[model samples]
Target: MASTPRSVWHNPVHFLAFGLGSGAAPRAPGTFGTVAAVVIYLLLPVSNPLLYSAILLLSFAVGVWLCGKTARDIGVHDHGGIVWDEFVGYWLTMLMAPPGWFWIVVGFLLFRFFDIIKPWPIRWLDRHVHGGLGIMIDDVLAGLFALVCLQLLAAVI
Candidate 1:
């Protein structure tokens, strides 16, 4: 049930298992976790332009550092169990947009797809960047990708 700390560094399964654990929930843990973060994000009065801007900015800055630190502490790089990038990504994706369940579902799918597919620069960043910021950067790119797609869909629909 538990991975041994001694071998965690060398064990690929342990690292992948730890990272992907976030997706293992009976339901959508990544979506659930992201939505939970949305509640906190919305509670901040970001409905105001200034405050919303701050939350977006601060979350990103903190995300880079915090996610990296957590990854290091866990002895893995961008482990799936660490979904803080999802937290920040969803927070930014939903900002200045409709908060309906439909939008939430759209955001969730887009984020996951982009994260997994890792197109263009997202793939490039994930491969080239190192450390915690590297981990967070790829997700940030995924979030941005989702944001752009969601915005386009909103326009068409």
Candidate 2:
């Protein structure tokens, strides 16, 4: 495991890319980062889909750059400590979700499940892609997969 350096916390880009330091957790940093993302999503006033989408897009754009930069600096591709992708991906998963703690928890589980499993094209993308885009796209697809599952559950329930 690549440890996060103290210098990474001091760098603005590294700070954000690491999901506000949640990614620096000794164990399951990606999971911690996703939890942090959930907290941020709940705090924000995101009833408007357009606004929510805009924020997700902007975050993803910046995440690609910052995540890539941090990975390069650390000399690793998609290091476990670089989890801005988790933040944006979780936000995307909750994009059209119903407003409730229940849904939020469900979304979190689903996103984590898909992200960890990296089924099909998600795994393919993760292996074949490179750089910042590579780091962001897999999580984005995982979020989309979770979104679909969440939507299906919502309809059924």
Candidate 3:
């Protein structure tokens, strides 16, 4: 069971932190949030790497605040329902990725893998860090790892 906060619907901050309500899912909220992120990524104009990078920068900054504030409000360090990190993580994985559904699916799978596995530094940060930045950093690193794998795969194929 997940803590689906009532504030998620009524509060904008909570809503965003909840990955626009996708994080409210009873199970695998992070996966659902990542799915929502794929939709959002498709809607954005990311053909330009610079623009995409800018979007990543801005979203990451705002996510730190949004996630931190929501955690404070909900009194949870990183609630299962708070999945803004997933949204940004998926976007980061897709940065500079070759444009195609195959690539998108690959990126999605890779991001999910790294996010779930949380190898080494990612796991360490998740355990040691606190608040919004803590919540966001692990996912960011996962995305970066996925990005590297995806890019390498793209190069090989």
Candidate 4:
């Protein structure tokens, strides 16, 4: 595995792209980043889907730049440690999610599952895409997939 960049600590863009430093974990950085995202989810006012959607849109937009710049600076395309995508992905998974720690945990697991498994077009896009947008698109899809599943589960149970 590549070394975690020191710039992650000192550079603001790298820091943010690294999921506020959670991505710097020695192993399972994406998981750590998603965990960090869980904290962000807790602080957000997710009762309003409009507000949550706005936040997801802004985060996705900003994450492209943040992830792109950090990858370029570090000379790695979609470095495992650049995990702002995970943050946005997890938040997307929780869109309109039921209010409770149970939902939060479920969202976390679902997002992580799809992210790691990279099902269908997600795997294809992850391989075909490049740059900052490349870094984000797969997780974005994973989040979307997880979102659909979670919403369905919510409706059923």
Candidate 5:
């Protein structure tokens, strides 16, 4: 693993891309980042799908630039500590989710599972893609996978 420099905290781009320092955790930084996302999602008033989707899209756009800049500064591609992708991915997963802590918890678990497991095309993309898009794409796909599952579960229940 590449060591994140102190300078990372100083750079605004790096700081945000690193999930406001949650990504700096020595263990499971991605998971920590996702937890941070969950907290952020809970804090926001997202009763409207259009607003939520717009925010998600904007985050993703900014994330691509920020993640790319941070990875360049850290001299690594998709550094484990660069977890802006996870933040955006989790938010995307929660889109249109039914109202409840139970669903949120389920989304978190499912997103993490798919992200960590990287099934099929997810793994392929992670291996083949490069740069900021690479870092964000796999997680986006994982989020989509989790979203599908959550929607199915919601329907079943």
Candidate 6:
């Protein structure tokens, strides 16, 4: 096992922001990444969908940089461990619906499912794109797909 680094993981907020080093999880880290996001989401004030969306958008916008740096620090390309992408992407997926517990749970699950499965364009983007933007775009597209499915389901019922 690698020795724990000093001054890193010592800061609670940074550690969590890094997804409890879920970014460091050896296998299927993005799934664990989404789980970490779900845990944090449960604690947030999400009574307003728009506000939640704004925050999510901001996270995606900023995620380009943070994910890049974290990947760099970890010496990887689109490393599964760094899940700020998953968090922001999942939040975006949930934004299309009215804020509620049921929808939130479903959104988290759906986003995780799609992200992990990487269907169609999501897979294409992941394979083709590179750099920080690439790190995030596929997940964003996956969230968009999940959002559309959700919106369509809402319309049908």
Lowest summed-lDDT stretch of 10 residues in model 1?
A: 15-24
Per residue, candidate 6 scores C-alpha lDDT tens digits across 14-113 of 3543567765566767777787877777765577777777788788877887767655665567765567788778777766576577777778778877
Best-to-worst order by lDDT is 4, 3, 2, 5, 6, 1
Residue-by-residue lDDT tens digits, candidate 5, 1-157: 6676686678888999999988998889999999999999997657999988999999999988888888887888999999899998999899999999999999999999999999999999999988888889999999999999999999999
Q: What tens digits encode model 1's per-residue C-alpha lDDT throughout 15-95?
A: 332332443344555565565665665576756868887877887787677667756766677655556677777766766
How much does each candidate deviate from the true structure in C-alpha RMSD? 5.9, 0.8, 0.8, 0.6, 0.9, 3.3
Model 2: worst 10 consecutive residues (lDDT sum): 1-10
Q: Encode model 3's per-residue lDDT on 1-157: one tens digit a residue.
A: 4478799999999999999999999989999999999999998778888988999999999999999999999888899888999999999999989988999999999999999999999999999999999999999999999999999999999
TM agreement with the true structure for every prediction: 0.75, 0.97, 0.98, 0.99, 0.97, 0.79
Clashing residue pair totals per candidate (backbone < 3 A): 4, 0, 0, 0, 0, 1
User: What does the lDDT read for residue 148 in candidate 6?
Assistant: 82
RMSD of model 2 against the true structure: 0.8
User: Model 4: per-residue lDDT, tens digit, 15-122?
Assistant: 999999999999999999999999999999898889889999999999999999999999999999999999999999999999999999999999999999999999
Q: Which ten residues in a row have the lowest lDDT in candidate 6?
A: 1-10
The segments of candidate 5 whose C-alpha lies over 4 angstroms from its true place after superposition are none
Ranked by TM-score, the better of candidates 2 and 4 is: 4
- Weakest lDDT window of 10 consecutive positions for candidate 4: 43-52
Q: What does the lDDT read for residue 43 in candidate 3?
A: 88
lDDT of 4 at 30: 95
For candidate 2, lDDT tens digit of each residue in 25-144? 999999999999999998765798998899999999999999999888878899898889999889999997998999999999999999999999999999999999999999999999
